[model samples]
Target: MTALTKNNPFAASVYVYDEEEYARMQMLVTEDVTAGVALKGDEVVSVFAHQDGAHPGVAQSMLRQATALGGRRLDCFDTVLPKLYADAGFVPVARLTWNDDYAPDGWNYETYRRYNNGRPDVVFMAYDPSAVGSLYERGAGKYVTDYDDGIAKTQAYQAASVGN
Candidate 1:
């Protein structure tokens, strides 16, 4: 894992993975790597940084690189980092309960609500529509169906919610 620290005190570590290897790992039916079946392609699995503030530039760079490597999208589950993802050209598409199987028990609905000031469950965001072309065929018409509408709605909601 190479850390991206271009003059930033808070450096983000990036991890690149062979898509087949990742898919195989995901299909783990046992505790053995060899037993897993490989899929195909390449992917940027993670880019993480610890800081007191958000780093949009770093996040954007990571997203760009992931897309360039054929990643369909970037997935982040951090409940407190939606703005960061948004600034990095991601749009919210769905929300999930904090108590989802993936999250720890400590992150239950009550805890999530209290800590997030009554915010909904985790927000799932996808990269910008403009970035979709890099991962799909041109004129394929297979891009995000609600890209434009979602962006407009989200922006309006944000503008209205700011300073509240």
Candidate 2:
């Protein structure tokens, strides 16, 4: 594990997973990884970061390092992210959709509502290390889907009474 620090000059800590951990997360996603960065409890499995004015390639290197480290697959989401992840050999698998109208239990209390208009809908994609060489491989797809904190972005507009 690299000791990423502020002085290190990277916007985010690029992670490299060990063999054991990689295996565990892969099972959750139904994929295999020879290696890759496991971020936020395998929830946001990103090999890239686009925050803080950083170049996109930093994320690219992290993805390559993950495959090199024994990651057989790359798990990712979002249209923008998938395109970049695809450039590194990943393919789209499924889409995770969210509906702002149907508020979940914790929905009334998080930053999630801020993204409501956009609704935080996401697309998930991956690459199998074994299929890295093939230009065409049989891949399955699904529209299957499954969020938050609250800082009051549009709270004032929300009314407690139906009559209001």
Candidate 3:
């Protein structure tokens, strides 16, 4: 039940590597804690999902969308959930001081970085479907169990389309 704001940035934007994914909408919002995704010039899709919503499916849904076109996309300015992202299908790209420069008006950068001695915490992750397998993929099931989303219907529709 938290409010979204620039200082409480809980969103992420990834740079898509594949041409196909780059053409698609580059943002996801599966929860209330997430902020609006800002599309930069090109190839860069930034989504802001606050850390508070990590336990829910906010980050997972966003990561799923980022890699939906085959996992050839990346750029996450994340300061949270490395293992969570790993289990969901993304690979760690780097761990470093947050390089995120985007902020909303009246946002204080100094206080934010002070959480880690004047450095914002962050880890970059990329989705590489070829390099890693998700937990659900290895679990016993024909499809990952996302009861809230109409995944079954979408799959059925695609399968039916292919048969035609």
Best by lDDT: 3
User: What is the overall TM-score of model 2 with all chains considered together?
Assistant: 0.42
Off by over 4 Å in 2: 1-36, 39-56, 73-75, 101-117, 129-140, 145-164
TM-score of each: 0.40, 0.42, 0.41
Q: Of the pair 1 and 2, which is ahead by TM-score? A: 2
lDDT of 2 by residue, 103-132 (tens): 333333243334334344444444444434
lDDT of 3 by residue, 95-153 (tens): 44433454333434564453443343344444445444443211111222222222333
Q: List the residue pairs that clash in candidate 1.
A: none
Off by over 4 Å in 3: 1-3, 6-44, 50-55, 81-84, 95-115, 121-123, 130-164
Error of 1 at 53 (Å): 13
Q: Which window of 10 residues has the lowest lDDT sum in candidate 2?
A: 148-157
- CA lDDT of 119 in candidate 2? 49
lDDT of 3: 0.41
lDDT of 1 by residue, 133-163 (tens): 2322112111233334433443443455343
Off by over 4 Å in 1: 1-44, 52-57, 100-102, 105-114, 117-120, 131-164
lDDT of the candidates, in the order given: 0.39, 0.40, 0.41
lDDT for 152 (candidate 3): 37
- Could you tell me the TM-score of candidate 3? 0.41
